[model samples]
Target: MSQFVLHDELWWVSEFSCESCGTRLCEHAGPGAAPDDVRQALLAAHGSVTLRPTGPAPGLVPVLRALREASGVSLPQARELAAELVRDGLAGTPAEMGLLRDALHRRGVPADVQS
Candidate 1:
């Protein structure tokens, strides 16, 4: 049987591995979304999580900085992700989104996660 493991680590990093074969499929670090295939696999094995900012709007600069610190993305990339968080929100594995939600909250950005 083939089995996969997913790890959501620091810096918004995620690692994927095969348990049966000891194969490492991916080790991604940064704020970018995981590949569709990886997402699908995770969804199949685990579940999905959605994260959205709640309460009053937070300062853009703080949001941007939080995104940068949490995701290890550059300023411009963090800007784009902060925009997305403010606009449509973000989706990922439970652990992934949970880490982000905590990071944002620590930076004084109110956010919630649903899984």
Candidate 2:
């Protein structure tokens, strides 16, 4: 059996790995759809995830903090990610966004994940 893993990092980076064959690929893009091959591999491996605010807008400060904590990014990068979260929403592998969702929730920013 083949085992695959999908990791969604800050800056819209997606890393795909297949344990069976030691194959790894990384895709980096702006705020848009993931590359077709990466998307397909992610869907096949861990499925898709959409993370959106469930309650009112959580304000930028808390969101930025959460983004930084979850992604280990610098303040500026986290700010950019927070902006994207508000503007375009967040999509990634379940575990990646799940961790962010949980982090935001802990900071009193309610969010939901659609898979």
Candidate 3:
């Protein structure tokens, strides 16, 4: 139910992802370098179609900054870490959070137990 906009030589409305990252700018081309091709490729690979404009969203910038600060990492480093977690399948699905919690417990990191 979320919405996103793909804008290049033209614009289209679709679902949202981290589109503002320029990862899907040329995703819709059947076989060319147009931003549309990039958009389609992104959807096929990452499962989203909404293209974000080429800049950080005003509000999200500060929030991301805070997360990075708290984690003691730069924004790019934090993003890379998250991406690695996803790629390595170390992250859990929403439904799998409970299972992940149990696994974490077995590893001695009890949930809600605080540091």
Per-model lDDT: 0.71, 0.71, 0.34
Sort all candidates by lDDT, best to worst: 2, 1, 3
Model 1 lDDT tens row, 49-98: 78898876558888887777666889989888877887888876776677
Tens digits of per-residue lDDT for model 3, 9-53 = 122233334656844332232321224454554445545221112
Clashing pairs in 2: none
For every candidate, C-alpha RMSD to the true structure in Å: 5.9, 7.7, 17.5
Q: Give the clash count for model 2.
A: 0
**lDDT for 46 (candidate 1):** 80
Whole-model lDDT, candidate 2?
Answer: 0.71
Instruction: Candidate 1: give the clashing pairs.
Output: none
What lDDT tens digits, residue by residue, belong to model 2 across residues 1-115? 1122234332345656889999988645443334567656766877777888887855778898888877678999998887777777798767568778887997899888886
Q: What local lDDT score does residue 18 receive in model 2, on the 0 to 100 scale? A: 89
Q: What CA RMSD would candidate 3 show?
A: 17.5
Best TM-score goes to which candidate? 1
> Which window of 10 residues has the lowest lDDT sum in candidate 2?
1-10
Candidate 1's C-alpha runs over 4 A off are: 1-39
